[model samples]
Target: MRYEKIKTLSELKNIIKGLRAKNKRIVFTNGCFELLHAGHASYLQKARAMGDILVVGLNSDSSVRKIKGGPRPVTKEKDRAKVLSLLWCVDFITIFSSTTPFNLLKAVRPDVLVKGGDWKVKDIVGSDLVTSYGGKVKSLPYLKGYSTTGLIKKINLLTPRRCAVRTYAAGKKGNTL
Candidate 1:
């Protein structure tokens, strides 16, 4: 019933400080999370398994559009954060407007930083920062054939025709129904 997991940068800083004092292993991961799919759920669960708490850096709507181009982030930032807050694996969620989570990661100073295998270790934002602080960095593989782009394509294919055709390829009349 509580949605306190979604916090602002300042609030998260305080929370992280307390968690660290308690010696909780914090794991951090960030993404646009445009569409909450099974792949995301699975990835978060696996990331959480590597530590005691999982903190997600949610990309803001404008950031998503800048990074992912137009027609992105079908869901709003607050909505995405709200949905992520529902996941048991997600201990905290913070909306960041930056294209990369470097600043947020610096603030979190998590015990672990994780990204999908699709990203190379050198390319992962904040990988070096985590490692510099003696934290672990991991690239977990994404679920096969479970991506937002693919889902959108499948949905487009299933959409019914808006206009009716009265003829077939052989010049034969066909029923609109």
Candidate 2:
């Protein structure tokens, strides 16, 4: 069911065209979304409330690696897209291999472009293109203390190094930890 929400760029463009014919407002946002969190859900919901449809442009695995460096994006792009597709607020998703969503924005031409509060409207990539076409650009409120990096760090702190090694050795020995 969630898989249906993921679309190719051409498919998404056609879908957007149809929606626009019916006067539906399209909201757009892009991110790596390496790990889903409460903050991501809240921001997406808020962005959806601003328009009739919400299209999320997910960064491909290579793109994430380029932007965030090695060993980032703990989850692969397909997995990330699948998780986001499960969210009710996300109408459709398109995976892009670019560092920025500027080209994707040019294709979607969303009615509203949004990003987390951490990004100023002027700093959001494609903000100029969106605004030039009379589309609105918004910076939604970012939830504090909720981030993938923080979650990863917390998880690392909770997993003792010795415990991890023991768990691995036990699994290899056909034993349960």
Candidate 1 lowest-lDDT run of ten:
159-168
Per-prediction tally of clashes: 0, 0
Candidate 1, residue 112: Cα displacement in angstroms equals: 0.5
On TM-score, the candidate that comes out on top is 2
Q: What is residue 101's positional error in candidate 1, in angstroms?
A: 0.5
lDDT, each prediction: 0.90, 0.93
Per-residue alpha-carbon lDDT of candidate 2 for residues 6-98, written as tens digits (9 for 90 to 100): 999999999999999999999999999988999999999999999999999999999999998868889999999999999999999999999
Residue-wise lDDT of candidate 1 within 66-169, one digit each (tens)?
99886887889999999999999999999999899999998899889999989988789988899998998999999997998887777667634654556565
TM-score each candidate.
0.88, 0.90
Best by lDDT: 2
Spell out the clash pairs found in candidate 2.
Answer: none
